[model samples]
Target: MLKRKISDYLESYFTPNRREALLITGARQVGKSYAIREFGKSHYSSFIEINLLEDSIARTSISKASNSKDLLLRITAIASQPLIKGKTLIFFDEVQVVPEIVTAIKFLVEEGSYQYVLSGSLLGIGLKRISSMPVGYLTVKEMYPLNLEEFYRACGISDNIFSVLEEAFKAEREIDSIIHRKLMELFRLYLIVGGMPAVVQTYLDTNDIKKVVNKQREILSMYVEDISQYDINNKLYIKDIFNLIPAELNNPNKRFILKNLNENTKFSRLENSFIWIREAGVAIGVYNIEEPKLPLELAKLRNLFKLFSNDVGLLACQYADGIQLRILNNDIDINYGSIYENAVAEELYSHGLKLYYFNSKKQGELDFVIKLDDKILPIEVKSGKNYLRHNALKNVIENKDYEIEKAYVLYNENIKRVGNIVYLPIYLMMFIKNREIENLIWKIDLSSLPQ
Candidate 1:
């Protein structure tokens, strides 16, 4: 398996003197189970893994125990190990199948001395079933589809075009046209193929777009299967919402409006079903930012929201018809503004920031608004060349309602700063990791801060 950045997150979660049981939540086939095992092999002396799907007996055994110690003993016996506390890492894979396993995790944390990491794609929806439990005993680490930088890394292209691109970003300089042209081509392919682990690995091995699309379809099929089985209560509605995705993208607004489903459908009828998709990590909810300032959640208009599918490659497949890989062959600027912006939003989300859209109603809209250190930074994405359209950023600056430090426009090339804003290549959004960006921010002098 390709190494993931989340490995470091797992290492820290398990190593801390003040460690807590962890809940790893993400969409299915996103490498959650594989990651847990990889992490265990690297960090723990002994690892106990239980797949709730394969071993129904294991689920029954863990569920029957009343206390943490008994449950630990039960898990150890199922894995055929002694119940050695504090030395072994216990992982519950496909944990959503048995909700009681979640409660049991909390019990173990409070009453026993073992480290634990529980994970499932369906785990987010499963959270709603909890009435009460040891809430403070667990921490959550949410994962998303791979970002562009990670995609290149996984493909083993990090040494050449990837490293060159990273240097351009670190220095905030434009890339050479030749390299830029080549990298942009890869970036566009990534948009169409996406960052799903299975899809990418298949493409890497076969160099086949058809195989990649097939893999994407398999993932989509699983969501459909889940709606029919686990989400049976809302089956028809889930199917209805899933079918709306293609049309939703074609809409200029791209927000999920119930009327968009069918002329006769009402918004009230699909509210919980929408929540179900977001909770299941099948869709991401990008709320409208009423104001670009602190307390971004305050700006949310519950009824007006933009939804990005869990995978960009899947979205591309939905938008494009057969025999048109030619579009990706040309350039990023030709036909990928909305799709690239959605991919950028996913990248930002992986950095642990909630995605919000800047809508002025009268003025133009910014692509994303990210909150960091209680400050809202408006991020506008463009596949166009470095031509600054700072009207939206200007509006925020002139209003003075929110102290706008600086705005970012993610374009196809790097740009010089003008006034209180900086233009950046959207590629950097995928290439630069959060820690590296955080370090960049630390090195910025207030004296040279954008005015």
Candidate 2:
């Protein structure tokens, strides 16, 4: 698949004048190595890849080297390639295996002379362990599962998909019915396949359900392995937390509760385990955002929060054989609500926002609290048109001063605005970023807006 966007980000770091050491961070098997390699091939004349975990000699060489320059020489010798100045790219894969190697990259970028990319699966864990080092020494690039645009490219759809969407966004017109249908089809597939690189690529080449299942299973298996490597002491607790997500998403509250696992289980008992899961990039905690502003942290819920897995594809697999059918709104509507919320959670997670939710002591619950620009936007997720009764949304609108820019409800239809509330189709949600839905909000004129 063409991951041009991520490559574009990497390009800025490698641009000769804008030289910086790159730290490619993501959950395991999200294609960090493949992306770094692709960038090197396209941008550099000679590329050298160092597998720090697989090669003992290279590890020893790096450790034994007296200084950063000596280490560079040893890496070049092991790669059997000349590390030319400016024209060569050096990739340090699995650099987290040796935390000190990250320190070395900072030295090489500032003191020595080389274009470098460093990547690791347990990158978050390593960073926490190595926190005393300089912070701004390297630029960080996050690689997520292939987003919708990338998924479209990987699926071999004509570039027309993006071009048409861009045109519609620019021209401010309704998309042709055929194009909308096609976009929806690709979107449904994305909901099922998710943006994981291996899963997307598997669907691209084979289009086989079995193959897709195997890839998801493989990625999950690798995560299981990571729990052991990264959290061996609390491995059992971590496994329990991981296994409980599919069940917890089924709950109406969605905020994780240890009691939901066992009536007696306590938060303090699983706090470290949950933190480990977040650090591993396998699951993330969405805190409550009470207001919108520069630092969204001021409005966080200390006790209640929701947890989302890194990829929706794995979450789908954990549920059933034909889970996509649930979206049609059958007798399984309750579970479908959980899945829809999870899907929305995945989209929000992709944007790298500080997520929180809104709720007053006597007021009801809203699905999400997201900050866009200077506005703190309250978002509510509805599985069907029936739930858009706007009880929760109306509560937040009338009672709270809340920066109160505007409110959003993600449901199953075209965009509509009633009073200060805007209703958006769940599919268009993938495009919402920085908490500003203005681009999406404008898609529907507020006058003939839904009530």
Best candidate (score: TM-score)? 2
Which tens-of-lDDT digit does each residue in 1-451 have in candidate 1?
Answer: 7778888788766764545788889988888888889888677777888898888899788768878778867876898565456678888888888877777677777765668888887777787786665578788888877877778677676567767776776666777887666666677778878888888889889988888888888988888888887787888988888777756755666777777566897667778888888888888889887777778888788877888888888787776565237556655435456686678877877777788888876666777888765676788776655456657767876677788787777776654467777777666776433443333434546886678
- Per-residue lDDT tens digits for candidate 2, residues 1-451, read 5565678778766778555678888898878899889889888888999888998888878878777778877887898577777788888888788778777666677754668888988677778777455467777767777766667777777766667665554344456677676666666677668778878878888887678877898888888888888777999888888988888887767778777666887777777778888877888788765544446687676656788888878888788776755532244343456667777776777777667766656677778877776676778887754855767677667755554767877765555567787766566665667534555443646897668
Q: Extract clashing residue pairs from model 2.
A: 145-195, 146-195, 287-356, 288-357, 289-356, 289-357, 292-376, 372-434
Taking all chains together, each candidate's TM-score versus the true structure is 0.88, 0.89
- Shift in Å, residue 148, candidate 1: 1.8
Q: Give the worst 10-residue stretch by lDDT in candidate 2.
A: 326-335
What C-alpha lDDT does candidate 1 achieve relative to the native structure?
0.76
Kindly state the number of residue pairs that clash in model 1: 0
Candidate 1 regions exceeding 4 Å error are 16-19, 81-85, 110-113, 159-171, 331-334, 384-391, 431-451
Against the reference, the lDDT scores of all candidates come to 0.76, 0.74
